[model samples]
Target: MSDQPAAAEPGRLTTREAAGRLGVKPETVYAYVSRGQLSSRRAPGGRGSTFDAAEVEALAARGARREPPLSGSDLAFRTGVTLIDPDAGHYYFRGVDATELAGRYGYEEVAEWLWTGTLRPGVRFTAPPEALEAGRRAAGALPVHSTAMDRLRAAAVAASAADPLRFDLSPDAVLRTARALIPALVGSLPAEGARDADADRLAQRLWRRLTAHEPDEGSLAVLEAALVLLIDHDLAASTLATRVAASARAHPYAVVSAGLGALEGPLHGAASGLAHRMLAEVLERGGAAPVVADHLRSGRRVPGLGHRLYRGEDPRAGALFALLDRVPAAGPALAAARDVVATTARHTDLYANVDLALAVLSVASGMRAEAGEALFAVARTAGWIAHALEEYAERPLRLRPRGQYTGPQPAQPLP
Candidate 1:
């Protein structure tokens, strides 16, 4: 749209050359431009267009950034995991909108979607009867103060022992075992047995295990939505650890163990539970301003307040809060959550994230103080397994990074 004649800049490419670089038809190149996925400028004589060669190449390579590696600092690695647009407060699971998917589906349905890139309904995740019994026995062996995550780790070991096909790496074999692990994990929690009638629904079963009370459909729906929302986020720290293990061709159980180890850290999966502890005080104090002021004054972060990815808002938090607002039993917790957000907004630019929503769910449902963390761990298993599958399809040990030597010279080269 320039008045003067347009001339191609050095290092840029004509339309045809851009298409060739991308290995796509010229029409496809135009489509990318139309969608703002790629940028192009008018060619010489104001005729066609010349695309930025670097932009076309980056698009072709999909996330390979040209930035130099910042050792022990921020990084961005190319991945084909779930796509998130935090500026828009939305994400997609393999191209499907996560909010839409969560609205109409349950956990395993979304899990299958993440794993196979297809939405198949009525899929069930259940293990053999004896396998559940084995997990229960393993969980029961843990001490009183041990966490639900500890019980899950113990149960994972027992279930691996029970599965004779645990080592099979075939796609079908891996998926079959993955399905079985979810149910076995659900049955492993330290809670009452499931009745025959409601045993078919994974959410219902998990509710019994976590709460030790009768399952309510509304709360179950909220849990399902949470699971779907948390299913897979691209290249999270725990997911990176999971892929590293999978790159070594470790079995799914071991991959899950690696993920659990990463999730145990306070900076990752445990943040939600910590938020719950802080929010519990809000519920008791009947106000959040004092709690927020105290946290800010102490130079401590308001737990579950904001996210690095989400610039405007967190869609996961929005989705979960919408569902929780409908449950009458969630009143007190929802009130406290509202206060937390309002108070934090006045003091800082931070907003509520998925962890805050998860903490709110814990308080409302009267689940254990640590239940938020356990829920995050359980929901993220779907993502961890999906990432493992993706890693297994790639060349092994592809995640190894070149370490820059920073220490004293290594003993003068072993002289």
Candidate 2:
């Protein structure tokens, strides 16, 4: 044999050839690229594009004939979770850490990072003149005087519906829609012209509008911390739902809708609601350890005490609890809640999940009972976009799956 290795069989493959090897159509291959599936770079001195045969082959092999049909939840559960460092945990928009970014950067900057995977060149927040004007107009359109949440939900639904391209799942369109719609939704709520009128001011400003009370620095800080902490958690149920839909090439709004539907359930994101209700019950029974003990003895699980992820203590809970130290009368409820948690932990491995701490924090800060869910909905939007972006990139198989037949088939049409 010659000393030189045998020539590799035409190492270079066009997109069409790569699609053929993968048993998918050319359009499907293009769909993948649009969704950020296969990595590509511009060919040197060429008009057409080129792909790495090795990379394409590896991706195909990994996707080959997997069982149970990949779903969003499956991907989420399988993808390794990077545990956030609670105290030092910083959310970077694209690359900038969130902790550093939140106070320094505007909400628009953060939103851009969440949607586009990175802050595009020259991304910065300037309070939109129209943002305040549009906010006032949107609020006026609502039923004269609605609750803070009413204004928020109305603005969001109306804005989303108005975006003709909201259904488009393509990377460029989704990012464009996000930039246009998100600021409108956040800004156009409650009448403007407040002491602080920066429509671009995110967490604190929004909190002020929602509460209809002067923003308490401590409470606002606590709320912001909660948002920052919970903004993303590895592949959560709702996040998975969004990803799965995105995999199917569903529209971005559709994908987000799927995730929101999943979140609306009691088991997933609504767990915080249960925690709040549980604490309310405890308060009604007199803020005493014995009352909590009796409730536990009666087979009622305290809502916020236990979590599925952290076996000992949830780091987010610890951070929030530490911050609440300065607030007045915030101690008793938290203490009683912790007492219940400790008592329950002796029997189960449950630790205080974020829900419990949030209930305490929100309630202590005097937010309306119904507001926590809305806050959670807002916070989770960040994660929803993150998952959507990933889906846009991966462009995995469609979400539809074959089902196991249990009952008789569609025969005997009219029995």
Candidate 3:
């Protein structure tokens, strides 16, 4: 036989050839493998990886078919509820500054205003006794190791089953459901301390479930502000899920359930828990430098330091940090959080986001790491309902988008 080596397989491409076909660096091709977006195999003699030519072509085609950047006129919906001004580093609910509303009013009052466009001073939300009982029972029945988010999901479903009028999608009915559901979601959690009086504000009631310590007025204020600040931001992932449910005319409870389902991932609602863990590590190590360094070394983002919509510090974080400054217990956690920001600032321009502020509250108050996630879910319930109401008025299923099929041809033979 001739000494010459065999030619490459007809259907395979080397790493460089694959990268060239995909119009990206060989490193990005490796990244695609790491992300499970593409597959590679060892080349003959184990010199380097080879990719299937057909797979590379398909990926390149998909990239070429990617849509252009969305404009205001493309897939935009009219909303009167919330507006975010990224340039100004501010957000508004009903055209009024969100921070102003959060500072001036309670969570219930702000929620009512967002729902009805009218504010009633001292407005309160109370769960019906029966609904609260059902929610608690369902939440309590979960496995012992179940997360707080799991209990919330269970409670939402139980609450829906208990509400016979849940199918009523009328505006008045949805408004009533919104009020009762928010409180029921809060009340379902097992209390860590003495049960709060029913007449207590929602924040006060929620405090008992989060920690055994009695809440001072300052800490309570911080919690209340956090609730109001988190009430809505603009079509967040969960809110969009809620809107899609509402567009299909699902009941308010189901809409909320959809939102809760979408809130489970770390990148969204559970982000605060990550921040809490990071801050706790910082406090334990007696400094932020080591913790930050470890995060960078491990290729993990230091959570709670950035917001896509804001150019500076998250306004919600600013509001909560201001209130936290007044509570003596928050001093150490707040300092640690500040240390994290300072330490990270040396490398990146990222500023503290609301997740960091929530972490400070949870750590200082001796609440579980999951406390911030619970606070986010309960507060954002109001926003979900508001979006539901908006979607209920729109043309049905307007949020649906057609998928572009990119798989093998339909006539392919069975394997």
Candidate 4:
């Protein structure tokens, strides 16, 4: 049998051509083959590989779609707090549609409902005078360069110290702690303007902390909706930490402390700040293309573009954006955000997540970049408490997972 070369296939593409069509390197094309994302055949001369042109185009069209990252543990806990239906592009809190709840109720009302399963209209949370004073003092003592989240952590510690009943794990005591602690967290931050009256809504008090601009009715509504939507989201990392603390019978304050600790990670609470900066840059640069290109060139995933849990737009984001549209001041920043989503969609199927919506609110309201993070921490305090209550009912220390040790054998001699 002769091994002479034959003419090239007309409908096929060489590795180089496929790379060009896919906007990637030939090496990446080979990687796709290894991962079974694409298939290739040996060329007629057996010297190189050839890909079907149709297949290459199809793979490129699929873009960056991927499965949600695994949490590395098989353990699951049953809870009635929140349900996220990714396929339906919606989430619910306690059997009620979360977006609808945000629309119809205030932050305090939703939070109260989540805690007790009873809807109390016109409910409000007030910071205890002693707890608020202690929190302010502790937060004020932090270095000048400390962030809003830093202040929140410091306040949590001091507030825990100020409460004589912090060690009480009873349901009623825990509820009292949550209500007072959330307001204390908000009050701890140095006010950016004249302090709001204690009787004001939580969103109004929080607004005073975030920006000096006077709050309009529309903007306050957006802030309230953000809080309601953020109240809980199934067991996030911080929620898990809060539950673990509760499993060990930690007091409500300490469980919240645990949650705040976990929330400080960049991949979690800090993500919105990154999105804020990105949106600002897009606005300054007068386009999303170059800013997005810079992020891609530096190998950074575009912030606020996607959520692992939602295959489409994050429901929380959708709800917030709908409200933001009514705020005239949000017009420019909102357009910038939309540009970011549209630009990224050219190469990937990602949709805007809650972080992006938060960035829009922060940017348009003249708030600092970290404002979104503070909002997340404050709102999620209620959720942490809800989970703590559930964990308190479970067997004590039930969350203690046995580690599968994969180190030196027990029989090994000490060095």
Greater-TM-score candidate between 1 and 2: 1
For model 3, where is the 10-residue window of minimal lDDT?
A: 1-10
Give per-residue CA lDDT, model 4, range 1-415, as digits (tens).
1211244489888777887888875545554553345666667756456778888888888872342443664247767688889999999987789999999999999887777655668988988899999999999999999999999999999999999889887655677798999999999999997768747999999999999999999999999999999999999999999999998999988998899999999999999999999999999999999999998889999999899999999999999999999999999999999999999999889999999999999999999999999999999999898888777765588776798989987888878
List the global CA lDDT of all models: 0.77, 0.58, 0.86, 0.87
Instruction: Judge candidate 3 at residue 218 and give its lDDT.
Output: 96
TM-scores for the candidates: 0.79, 0.66, 0.82, 0.82
TM-score of 4: 0.82
| Each candidate: RMSD | 12.2, 9.2, 21.5, 22.2
The 10-residue segment of model 1 with minimum total lDDT is 64-73
What residue pairs clash in candidate 4, if any at all? none
Q: Candidate 3, clashing residue pairs?
A: none
For residues 1-415, write the lDDT of model 2, one tens digit per residue.
Answer: 1111222235655655666777775444444543344544333443333456886788688873232554654433332112344444322333344445444444444555454333433353332444435545666687754654455455555565555556665455555555544455456655232545444345665575456655556767777676666666666787777778777777655665566567766676667767776676667776546655666689876677655555556766777787677666577668756766876766666778778887787566556565566566666666666566655545368455677889976766786
TM-score of 1: 0.79
2 against 3, candidate with superior lDDT: 3
Q: For candidate 3, give the lDDT.
A: 0.86
Better of 2 and 4 by TM-score: 4
